[model samples]
Target: MFKWASYFLCSFAVLASKGSWATLQDNNQTVCILKDAPNQCGSFCLSALDPMQTNLDAIERKQGVITSQLWALISRQDVQQKSLPSLDYELRRHTEMQEKHISHLLAVQSEMQALQKEMLHSILDVYKKLNAHQTLVQESLDKSITKEVFENRLEGVDKQLLTIGSTMAILMSRSVDQPHTVQNQSLQSPQASLQESLSEIGSEPPQFEQIGSRHFFIEHNLRLNWTMAAQRCRQIGGHLASFQNRLEFNAVTAKLLTGDVYYWIGMNDLGQEGQFVSVASGNPVAFFDWGYGEPDNLGGNHDCVDIAHAKMWDSKCADEERFICQSDNEV
Candidate 1:
């Protein structure tokens, strides 16, 4: 029995050793798989992220283009707003200019109306003066016609007187030679006296006197004011005597027989103060023979000149005095 037990124990020890070696090999393979798991997971995540990043970049580019377009539209709106105020200011200035032009036209119309009124008044005044002048001219014409009729009648009377004187003288000459008896002697004396009277009546004195180619008439019966004396001279186709020099004055004075009688001359100061002029000649008097302190402008109204002998004196025009008349002789 002891020999059989020893062989069995040796076989059991060999089997147990082979089973332990197989378990050690399995444990080593499991440890290697655990170590390589982190590397595989990292590679899978990297590949998925690449496509998502590309899509985000495209969205950002579209948003930038939209923002630029909005800014351009706002800039155009701002420019239009600024131009509106400038247009309104120009319209207001034009309206004011039109108003000023209308006001100026109204003022010119008013001034023209005032000037027309003044012209109308001046025309009325001229018409009044013309009516007064016409009345004076009619009165002067009537007086001249009456004076001419009286002069014609006087000429006829002078002719009748001359014829009667000549017939009486012829009758007296025939009766003187036929007388001697008492009745005849008385008749003869009266006839002689009649003849002598007839002879004296036939020779009449001349009315006018000639001096230095000028004829002068002295009105001894009539005395008149300066104005009336000038009118009388004109009626006889002559003017008042105007002396040119000392010799002419002396010649005129010698004809006057009446002493201390003042006679009106042609000189007067009717035109201006202290400026004596001739009425007949219409010239300044060169020869002056004024008496001492004569032209003192008495009563501030002495405007006429009168002469006594060879001396001159100033007198009022209304005073009564005889005047000398002169005229050019018919050639």
Candidate 2:
């Protein structure tokens, strides 16, 4: 019996080491309750409990390692939760800043548009004023031109009337002096006799003096302004006398009587100051016969040329003087 107990103890010890002690306890519990098998069965049950206790201790250590890992995971999750509100606040601030920038840009655009509209209005107003001023200037210039034309026409009419009155006065004076002589001469048809009497009493034709290729007529009895002298010359199919050289000037001056009177020549500086030109040919005066600093453009108004004592001098165009006319006999 001692040898069997020793063998059972050794076997139980081997099973406990192998970790199968709980199965052995369930199978041998009824045997351990018998009085005859109490000591050996209790010993066997105690040996089996030892292996179960060791197995329970190893399982508890593995559970403690798993709980520690779960706690670490919970701590990380809490930290992430704590940061969420700060991140949300930063995002909201950025959005508000962007909205304010957009509002400022819109306001600047509106102000620029308003300034541009005001500038356009100011420019339009200036343009209207300039247009009105230009219209007024044009109207004033047109009225001035019309008045000048009317005055010139009236002057021409008055000159013609004066010429006709002078001719009628001369004819009436001749008729009063020779009334019986005019009646005796009208024995033929009244129209033929009247025509003959008119031809006899009319002004005589102008006598011309020939020099070179030109014919000249000196009107010593007529004293007129430069403009009127030129007109009278044109009436006789001639222009104001113009000399080409000193010889022709001397010849013309020799024909005139020496006195205090001056005769108008064709040269004038009316076109431009200091540039004497011939009124007949519209050419610069190549021949200068100025008498001792006489053409100093006296008083800045002496624009006409005159001959005095065979020398040329500048004179006012309004001065009334006798003038000579010349015709191109070659034509």
Candidate 3:
């Protein structure tokens, strides 16, 4: 027999003979019969009717495994519960950003409409003032009978006419880029005056072409980087050109030759990442003509915009290329 087995048997025999701290139980797990009497309680009480030692150890191992699995389940539940709030926050934030962007666009549109109405009212006032000046000049001419008196009156009328003309020019200058606003064609159109003003100032760039209502200086020969190109346009009383719609874009791009050539445009996101605006006016761009997989913002440095074959794409701002300039077109 094993040492432990012999030791256990000796201890049990000693305790049973002493008849101390032992009692009979419901099961047959008897350590020994009562003291000297038969079928009676004993001094030592142990569960001899329990499972074998090997079976007990296996049950213990199984219980440990079950406890570990339960703890694993509890830990996973805790992690998932902790992550739920963060995921919900991100979703709500994205939705709010989208709503704000849409509202801003609507506000800009309404503001533009308000500005147009104000301009029309101002123009009407200027016209009425001009007519009154004309009537005063005619009345002075009819009232003067002598040539010397008429000459003095005519000279005075000429000075007043010059003043009125200057005021009209200033008002007309502000309407160059507002193509959607109402204008009186019978009077002087702003477009004609714009051309005349450009002629008088002698600031029109060489080789500039008129496409639709806007004029563009598509400089295919001069290769310049984005910043340099914008500076060059400023030197010529213009900026890198910006297009407002597909028709204007197509009309201007149709003039370019077919090849791998690209031209710098005014659209850029330098002020804020992912928010493209005109480099000259610093306003959000109104139109987009992106190419396939365009605006990938490759290398995170593609903040400038370029156009080729009528399609736009984002590119590094420092790269040298051809560029277009426009003086009258702010869109």
Best by lDDT: 3
Worst 10 residues of 3 by lDDT: 37-46
Model 1 earns a TM-score of 0.37
lDDT score for candidate 3 against the true structure? 0.76
What's the TM-score of every candidate structure? 0.37, 0.39, 0.40
Question: How many residue pairs clash in each candidate at the backbone level?
Answer: 0, 0, 3
User: For each candidate, what is the lDDT?
Assistant: 0.66, 0.74, 0.76
| Per-model C-alpha RMSD | 37.2, 32.0, 19.3
What candidate 1 gets wrong by more than 4 Å, as runs, is 1-207, 328-331
Cα lDDT for residue 158, candidate 3: 100
In model 2, which runs have C-alpha deviations exceeding 4 angstroms? 1-205, 329-331
lDDT of 1 by residue, 1-331 (tens): 3233333333333344345545656665322222332343344333444465467567767777777777877877787778779878877877788778778877887788877878777777777777777777767757666767766767777877777566545454433322221122333455455433323322332256887656787666567889777755654556677777777788888777567898987788988979998777777887888899978999999999988867898999999998888763221
Error of 1 at 206 (Å): 8.6
Summarize candidate 3's per-residue lDDT along 2-27 as a digit string, tens digits: 33554565566667654543444434
lDDT of 2 by residue, 3-30 (tens): 4655666565555543444565666532
Q: Using alpha carbons, what is the TM-score of model 2?
A: 0.39
